[model samples]
Target: MRTPHSHNFAGKTRVSVLLACAALLAGCKKEPAAGPVPGGDAQQGLRLVTQYQCGACHTIPGVQGAAGEQAPSLAHIGRLSYIAGGIPNHPANMMQWLRTPHAVKPGTEMPPMGLTEQEARHMAAFLYTLR
Candidate 1:
């Protein structure tokens, strides 16, 4: 069962995703960090959020929610709208969003946390299970 409305709806979704990703990529380029470096996993990912000061804005559960920033709470990323350049809400996209939201959606206020690709993927996996 197909309809013109469905096609139009899909188009809008795609457009939104593309715009997000483009914005992200444009904003992703920056100087890498310099340090001894810490471990990276889901636990480390949680720590990384702190290191990157994500809680300063977003209200992720298990992380400090009292930071009182304008960012949205991320208690349930899998069931959200418009992550990863409008890519459907899934684990992969969530991971990509965490790792490189600006890369995925240029001009996003969310900065790159300098997470390794692996760490980002693991964090995304953790985010999906938060629901």
Candidate 2:
């Protein structure tokens, strides 16, 4: 005994319910991990940052006297999806950039920091904690 109007109303209700369910599922999706790199000590990395004088050109949080305006602020480096103008912000890429900025992106403002592999690893571990 349903009228044409009632049939249309039921179809609209079904579509609305389906849309709500899809939105809920999308909201439940997990994000990528943002923890420190393996075998890289965050404390050591912090010390290395100071030792390397990174504060001279970049503003880094949790670091005293690191308020340089020459480079970008590294407050939330961990949550960033990309860095160094466009490179993916993975641990390996971060380490490579820390070791050789010019090689990663020629003509970039970041100069060669002369960091060893282990040092770069430690630095990356520390930088990732900015989130």
Candidate 3:
């Protein structure tokens, strides 16, 4: 004959086990593929990067003459987990950073490139291809 306290303990144990399983599943989730971004054109993005002269600060891979050392090299930006050191490296986040970096992270050295939505998307698509 179990007491009321015993029943409560059993329930709590079940809850704890469920929570642990959920945590484990979440941890096991795979990272997203470094594929092309939807509705974005990598070729157009390359053009935009060239037009904007992003190589002036960032060392982009595909674009020729993109050998600037003032900022970090985007050799494999797609594999990176974070942008601006905090923002998640998702397509939306990357586009936002490219459009208005100051809005995403105040006082960031990356200045806003004044990119429209489509341009940002294209840029993100190209950047993701670096992986």
Candidate 4:
């Protein structure tokens, strides 16, 4: 039997099925890898953080007496999408920033502490574990 209400019901069912399929496909998508940052050690990184005295200008968790208000808090830095609220939040980018904050962001208050490549890598490793 054909009726106006029956046609609307059929259209609604088709739309519902399409939406359900789209959701199922989205759920099946794989997530990005969450492994340790390459060539970086969290423990060594933590030590370097203390050695560099980063706590003096920045608030860092797990570092005693790192309660600085000059810079942003690094409690969950790993979860941040970008560094300095501008650059992408990736290991390579982070290392570069740590090594050369002035070059990355000119006229900035953060100074170049003269960190070696190894030191930057270790610092990046420690920062990535904040999440």
Candidate 5:
């Protein structure tokens, strides 16, 4: 008496439930992909941030007493859709922004910290893990 559409929907539901159970039973706890993200050490980046005196202008989460009033809080920077609310929020863009804030956003108040590419990458790596 049931329609073919009902049978199809029930089959789809059963498949979905089976897939979910299989995923749960598999203990899916995969670690994040290894790459530049894992390549750069967060601890090293933390040290660099302090060494560069970034806390003076920005509020960072892990760094001790890094709460500054001049800049935005980077506590959730990883989840931001854009850098400076304009450029795409990718690691490369972040590194460029960190190295040359003025170039990215001319007339901006953020100063150039004179960080090398590698250093900026390390910082970006750390920032991307903020989420």
Candidate 6:
């Protein structure tokens, strides 16, 4: 003969198993909420530039480049007259370019990157420090 407390515990165990199964079934469903990170790291963005071999094309001061030819560097992007091939330079635009290059220049070689808005800003900040 089982005690009253044991029966209550058994009922709770069954309820827990049911809730677990419900949760397992819920995991089979799909949801749509994939998006870019809200903010980014500029220093990490700069590091990523080197890590992703961007220096091969761009003539950045610190990073090394294997190619004999180098693209215009960001040594002083903050002070430049224009960016994105001379479409008017601004930190926001620079961040836009850093995030989505193709949107700014359709046939440019520079590709979108792994930087966040904050990171791009930080990167812009770092670049401003160059000169």
TM-score of each: 0.54, 0.75, 0.74, 0.73, 0.70, 0.54
19-124 in candidate 2: lDDT tens per residue? Answer: 7658657553243334459989889999999998899998999888888899999998887888977998888889989999988899999988899999999988
lDDT of each: 0.61, 0.85, 0.86, 0.82, 0.78, 0.62
- Which ten residues in a row are the worst by lDDT in model 3? 27-36
Residue-level error in angstroms, candidate 4, position 74: 0.7
Residue-by-residue lDDT tens digits, candidate 4, 48-99: 8988889998999999778888999989888787878698788888888999
Q: Report the CA-based lDDT of candidate 6 relative to the real structure.
A: 0.62
Q: Which ten residues in a row have the lowest lDDT in candidate 6?
A: 28-37
Model 5, runs deviating above 4 Å:
1-39
Weakest 10 consecutive residues, lDDT, candidate 5? 27-36
In candidate 2 the C-alpha lDDT for residue 21 amounts to: 58
Q: How good is model 2 by TM-score?
A: 0.75
| Span of 10 residues, lowest total lDDT, candidate 2 | 27-36
User: Looking at candidate 6, what is the lDDT of residue 104?
Assistant: 87
- Please tell me which predicted candidate would have the highest lDDT against the true structure: 3
Error of 1 at 87 (Å): 2.8
Best-to-worst order by TM-score is 2, 3, 4, 5, 1, 6
Task: List the candidate numbers ranked by lDDT, top first.
Answer: 3, 2, 4, 5, 6, 1
Model 4 weakest 10-residue run by lDDT:
27-36
lDDT of 1 by residue, 15-131 (tens): 977776586575532321111122324666666666666777777777765264587677766445455346666555666777778767888887777777777765665454444
Query: lDDT per residue, candidate 5, 7-91, as tens digits?
Result: 9999998897677658658553333221245356777788899889888988999888798989998888887778686887777
Q: Give the Å error, residue 58, model 5.
A: 1.1
Q: How far is 42's C-alpha from truth in model 5 (Å)?
A: 1.7
Alpha-carbon error at 91 in model 3, in Å?
A: 0.5
On residues 77-125, what C-alpha lDDT tens digit does candidate 3 reach at each position?
Answer: 9888887788889898898899989889999999888899999999999
